[model samples]
Target chain A: MQEKVHVSGGTALSEQDVHSGEIFMTEDSLDCAFAWDTGVAINRYLTELKNGRIIATECRHCNRIMLPPRLFCELCFKPSSGWVYINDTGVVNTFSICHVHWDASRIKEGEKPYLPAVIEIDGASAGMGIMQLLGEVEPEKIKFGMKVKAVWKPENERTGSITDIKYFKPI
Target chain B: MAILERITRNIDNRFWDPGSEAFPVKNRYTAGMAGQRFFKEIKENGKIFGSKCQSCKITYVPARIYCERCFERLEEWVDVGTEGTIYSFTVVYKTKSGKPKESPSIIVAVKIADGLLIHRLNGCSVEDIQIGMPVKAEFKPKAERRGGIEDIKYFKPL
Candidate 1:
């Protein structure tokens, strides 16, 4: 014998069919927490940030000095060659003016749009860049290949985070 | 050994480093098929409904589409009473963000027939709540009703 399935309300499956006694709906809230280890290279990189210095790891086999340092080279499949201090100045590779917040909420009236940009660090290999916020310049005036420098927060206020370098401003 | 010690020393006492932090995530959830119907009944009709498994003769509060014991599809729906007895309770003093609230909130697991309904308890003090205490759901006014368990403001002493 064939099994029969009966759904609440009627035989219709559309969302509109849920209007009255048909479809019952409810909402629930859940919270999850996690802890992550940043490991060796990044640990040292963040430490350098506290001292107001920018550093990168060099991949000996590939001859590339990468920022936001990693212990192993993705391209060469080898351990990093060594650590090197890099200049805080960089050139903007690309950028966007966002009117929406990270949570998708609309920016309130009179607030400036967030400016995020990809910056190619001066001492790293060509085409190597990291995404960071851009500030102190009008959105319309920002241009590709614009020279910028990291604006460091006061040493006492620095917490060894990317925010330690407050933002990149046009030089 | 020297290099390893240097690396470890650099990382020591850096627990409060903002750079070494993980981002928090927020998620929203929707009640499945059976829950949708159960909440709807309470919201629209001011009534509680349960799903019954004909095979096992078991009914589930806040209805489910299938029976847990018999693994049979539950097709029959029944109206359940709003009055129930408190099976368990707790006084919550902290908000989700870990901040303490000005006043404590009372949460209760109410035992109706078949299963339990967990909701906030109001109109009673923390000192007054007890196991097996009889209570009835107090729904929001009709004009204020907007479905979900919150449609019932809370359960109160009968």
Candidate 2:
């Protein structure tokens, strides 16, 4: 029997807000956030605390691991054939200081004005990483290739959530 | 795509909920008291507020606990005007429940007085609203406020 599927049509631009300096066309500014994918359900990693964990699917063919855990492997065009446990400790491969809280609801509720970083987990292959919050490290002290380790919640307190590890810290 | 689904029907839900049995129950996220109070304010008051950086004049709409500009802890709150302009927007044709509403809901990025807010646009037809159009914030009915994002309902043209 054949199965049915629903495909969402691409969204149309509903509005725009443009600003420009009266004196110069070079100063034109446009700011917009597309009303796309407001809600999503992605597979997240489980940590010792109630913190969420992010898992990576490894492709046996290429021995490549994918983070943000997708179902397929891009390297060998193969589906995820296996799963691997990743070490919580990693280095700050790259990071950014978010000066603005992008979402009003989250910001008003006090979700922003924090740093978001992408870390290369220890023992995880290159290109396999997790995006998470870092604590104990000041914003000014954060630097590229900084050694850090996951501070997992105590064994008795762990609940297979990312919050299990309160946050990462310098090694 | 159809072929993929036909072969994976049995495993679809399994793959979707690998860590389903943990925390606050499956699919449900719990917030702290502060978060709860924040949403309650949105339901009760039509106004939105952001944290103001004491060091810098930057205002974060939907306030932040810390200053984004100066990396300072911000404990003060300031109310932004309920009114703002549409920064960007889109009309959603489908909803999660499978049943579609008669009118397409317009979701917009509205620049409230202090910061930008993303919410649904109500009170007017989607055609009537345009980018850079002025709008005012309004609360959903008290009974309809679910202590969630829907609490504010949507922004409407002023």
Candidate with best TM-score:
1
Question: Tens digits of per-residue lDDT for model 1 on B110-149?
Answer: 9887889999999999888899999999999876776677
- How close to the true structure is residue B136 of candidate 1, measured as C-alpha lDDT? 99
Error of 1 at B43 (Å): 6.7
Please give the lDDT score at residue A78 for candidate 2.
61
Question: Candidate 2 chain B: minimum summed lDDT over ten consecutive residues — where?
Answer: B1-10
lDDT of 2 by residue, A25-87 (tens): 112223222222111122233321234344555677787766655456667676666555566
- Lowest-sum lDDT 10-residue window in model 1 chain B: B1-10
Q: Which stretches of candidate 1 lie over 4 Å from their true place?
A: A1-39, A154-156, B1-11, B16-33, B40-48, B55-58, B65-74, B80-158
Q: Against the hidden true structure, what lDDT does model 1 obtain?
A: 0.83
Task: Residues A29-99, candidate 1: write the lDDT tens digits.
Answer: 34444544556777777789889999998887898989878888889687787889999999999999999
